[model samples]
Target: MDYESLYKLIPKEPKKWLTQDVISWLQFIGLGQMEQKFVECSIDGAVLEDLTEKDLDEELGITQRIIKRKLLNWVNHGLKEYNEYIKQMKMPNLNNKKQQDEDFTIQKNIANSQFEQMLIENHENNGNDQFTSSVVRQEEQAIKQEIPGFNKFEHQLILQPIEGQQSNFYCVREAGAKIGRHSSNQILILEENISRFHAEIIFQDSMFALKDIGSTTGTFIKILKSLTLIQGMLIELGSNQFSVQKLDLLDNGGIEISLFVVEGPNLEDTIIFQLNKDKPSVALGRKSTVDISFPEDHHLSNQHAKFYLVDQTVTIEDHGSTNGSWMRLSGEGKMSNLFYLDPNEEIIIRIGTTNQYICQQNKMKVNEISGENLCIICVERERDCLILPCKHNATCLKCSKNLALCPFCRVKIQETIRIYKN
Candidate 1:
């Protein structure tokens, strides 16, 4: 029999290492000892040239009836564990295929979550590695920023028009915004780094239309018009969501100038700006200042920026944008550009605007690691598992049921137990 098959035949768990079932399995495999030497030898792959029931009994120093009973039990136990593992492994793929057959709506949602996680990890690790704790924190931060506040909606600024500035707006989300006031037309002309901002401008009847700014992060629209049709109303677009019904911008300024949130989501978040109803209005002074860079001094911009406290390690990839990003390792150098990342490095992005894409280096201190308060499910024997916010911890399902408190913290979750499905 294959060693791998045998490995599965025996419980992989150390806690179950010497159970009666396991002993029985060894007996069935002819590894049980009447004399102890046969059992010892069998474990190391050595065996006798000739075999008989008495020989086996002699080898185990046990009676034939006892050996036979243990052997049968061993085979049964091995089969049970094998069947369980097979069932568990097949569930996820089978569920995915079944979801596909059912039109993939739910599967797509799950896929998108996984995809967004991948993209976020790529950004965190600069797209050169898999996710680590540092990378996961960045992704979780991105997710938090994208979908903050579970209950009601929220609004934020995208770009305030910058006038008479000779700055290059790299379509890479962090670039600054440009706004121009056409004196003769009396309209605000807002120009965003087309690469960073995302919008969908629908041309409707030249008078009425809609604008949906799809983004993974988020897009906000604040209408300054009191015409009831377009003023002070906040429009938000989620990933793949839409916005409908609005005015056209053919006549406002040389072009209609309106503020649009840019560079929040991934590539799909960028869309065209379409404003309806072109009206001549004098340039309104910007209520906000125009900066050419993100905040450079934020503490989050530490050299160990990618030190996520969650799953560790990640890869990075640059999208070939101007003003490249970099990673600053602690005690390494002032700042260095990178196309990839190791487990311990931090991340930093250079942008054209005053905003600094600085991420704080989360410490994986002993307290943080040991202070964690949840149940974890460890699946891979070769790798360590992390505990998520859910009450699950790293252990087999069978072991988990016997515990009352969170395994890591000993906090009593008396009436509740979190179950993880494949």
Candidate 2:
């Protein structure tokens, strides 16, 4: 039989005996006597609305497609009845409207008499208007206290700019607050890079979360690392104290790194290096043996610095170069003589006059490198030839044989040198 026909067979007073029992509700909805045992075993204590087709097919041995479909239809009909039953239970009895009206009228009279007495008391106290205003304010506060989800100390999300100058704090009073270029958003960032509705900060279950909402540029959080210092041990960097135990340069795992020369003579330079999983360490230098080599720059030492990732923490130590290295902490514009870095900190490495920005990213983004270590001319073979004078390494040996000028800088190729990788 169809669901509509079976639904008609259910008793009108099923609510009196339903008690949220799945089997009883199914039976009331005209489920067959033979199928009762299977339904009971599958959903012994489930609610009517919670019943799904998958539950019956998987939990019960109901392999027949036609039988399962019919059973699902009946369960859907039962859910509708369950909703109606709940609606009926919550509905006030309109049959006793006259008595309800009388009760409301009596309460209204008592409130009005009390209000009149309060006004009289205020008048007797030398007509103190401030005292009367204070009582009204107190009543408003009491009403606010009775409101659902009202909080005096609402959680706030603070967005500090990368430059470390100013911060925007949002008092999250509702479930969520929008941050975008639009004025309608709770926090409006008026920048060309920001979209109309860039992101949303949601406060749910006493926890705050940020979600990017189809933004063109996308939203990013500056991942901050916590610092732990041992008692009586200090590695001073001007006013800051870094732990000596945390400064072990040989410590190694669990981090990927990307280095970029943010401010330098060559703006196109980018180096992406993944730490060795077994021994999580990377060396930066002018030497060819290092993981990352800056051969063009004379300012960098042969073995400039080393970055270590150990116990889920990242630390950097200088290799004692003639030109000492300096680090710029995250959110700061200026660089400091800090030799070590805490986890999640973005430090600008200054080797002599050259400045390189080192960022510890969640993953290594190789795609960010334009033309990605491949020959620019052929686009098939790896770039093994370095075009000298310009020092542009953007061509293979076969492609470099025909080219007179560098593909990148357009400088005359004094020599075409083939670079061999180990």
lDDT of each: 0.29, 0.46
The model with the greatest TM-score is 2
Residues 102-154, candidate 1: write the lDDT tens digits: 22332233334445646655686674545465457645644543443522211
Evaluated against the true structure, the overall lDDT of model 2 is 0.46
Error of 1 at 26 (Å): 6.1
After superposition, candidate 1 runs with Cα above 4 Å error: 1-39, 42-55, 72-93, 96-142, 145-422
Give the CA lDDT, 0 to 100, for residue 204 in model 2. 59
Please provide, for model 2 over 134-234, each residue's C-alpha lDDT reduced to its tens digit, 9 standing for 90 to 100: 57864774465456544233333322122321233222322456766788887665666666776565655554545556555433322112232222222
Q: Name the lDDT value of residue 268 in candidate 2.
A: 36
- The best candidate in terms of lDDT: 2
